[model samples]
Target: MKVLSKSISLFVVCLIVITIWWIGTDGFTGFTQETARVNKLIEEKPMIMPITLEDSKGRMYTFHELKGRRLFLTFIYTSCGTVCPQLEKNMQQVYESLPREILDEKIMFLTISFDPDRDTVEVLDTYRQYFGSDGETWRMARIANKLELKELLDAFGVIVLPDRYGGFTHNSAFYYVDENGRLTNVLDYKDIEGAQAFLHNELLGSEMK
Candidate 1:
């Protein structure tokens, strides 16, 4: 009887652990950092707040101005030696994989910097150039003011915190917004193939020839 009870208790504990892990990792699809993906499904109404940004060239753009156009947006800091470079590379890959028709009129790629104080217009422009960014296809920018920057980051679920190394530690992902300025999806930047498929199908419906 004692042996049977111990076995039953062990089985129950194992089952509980498995259940917790499954929920935390989205059924083993990914980890809890995938809140953006999980949130999309649960979000009854998706919306974006009014925000303004200054591009690498010192040009201003706002939510109102960018309406009626789908946007592929990401956040980064030019000084980042690790994750940011990979994110930009992922952006470049996605941009190149796009069709001219979509690039010309359907969508825009916006890379906004969360590190405004350190990333000036000149600095951002230089960074963009280093990445071989075509100004029209990809416009890197910084929020004009602190208030709007916080709002934008919070709304998109991006968390930026200073690290011990006098740098930042923040969550990174590809934030996808629809024409009406509502966030429709958020994908991991490392998932290059998924990003391409999502962008193509969402914009062109059928793949370009």
Candidate 2:
């Protein structure tokens, strides 16, 4: 009787351990599946053109590098003391709140300057530092030509109308890209809160470590 009881107790303990392990793995697996479902819905949204550009540091990074991770990209001119400043601050908030693991997990941030003629590599570098960028994972690029910038913006469906005071009245949007390097959603820069939640639930939440 004693031998039988010991064997039964051991079997029960093993069963319990297996149950916990299964739950630990399966729970996150289920969440990933749900995230995938939402991502499929996100794919139905219109796509944007991908640009290959040189960063302030002279490194070449393409939209292709953005694959296997999530991307948040924006257009800005550093010299503007207007809405651009507000947008930068809001972007800082979004970046600060993101999980560190997510930042390391193939995530990218791209800031393209509209006034590329004045936004040389030196200017871009200084501007990026103002936003507290560490330079390990972000790209700040200069447009190099007014016409080229306008054409690219138009291709992406973002418009930048010149302001009389040398600044521009441009469309303010924060673009999201998925792990497949495909363009996803375009949200207002001021909608940082909503943007964070959307990306977390729809993208990062499904990321494999």
**Best lDDT among the predictions, by candidate number:** 1
RMSD of 1: 3.3
lDDT (10s digit) by residue, model 1, range 99-203: 888887889898999999999999988999877687777889999699999988877778899898868888898888888888888887999999999998998
RMSD of each: 3.3, 15.8
In model 1, what is the error at residue 171, expressed in angstroms? 1.2
Candidate 2 ranges beyond 4 A from true positions: 1-50, 145-148
The stretch of ten residues in a row with the least summed lDDT in candidate 2 is 32-41
> What are the clash counts of all predictions, listed in order?
0, 0
> Considering every candidate listed, which one attains the maximal TM-score?
1
Q: Distance from true position, residue 26, model 2, in Å? A: 43
Model 1, residue pairs in steric clash: none
Candidate 1 lDDT at 186 equals 83
Off by over 4 Å in 1: 1-31, 36-45, 206-209
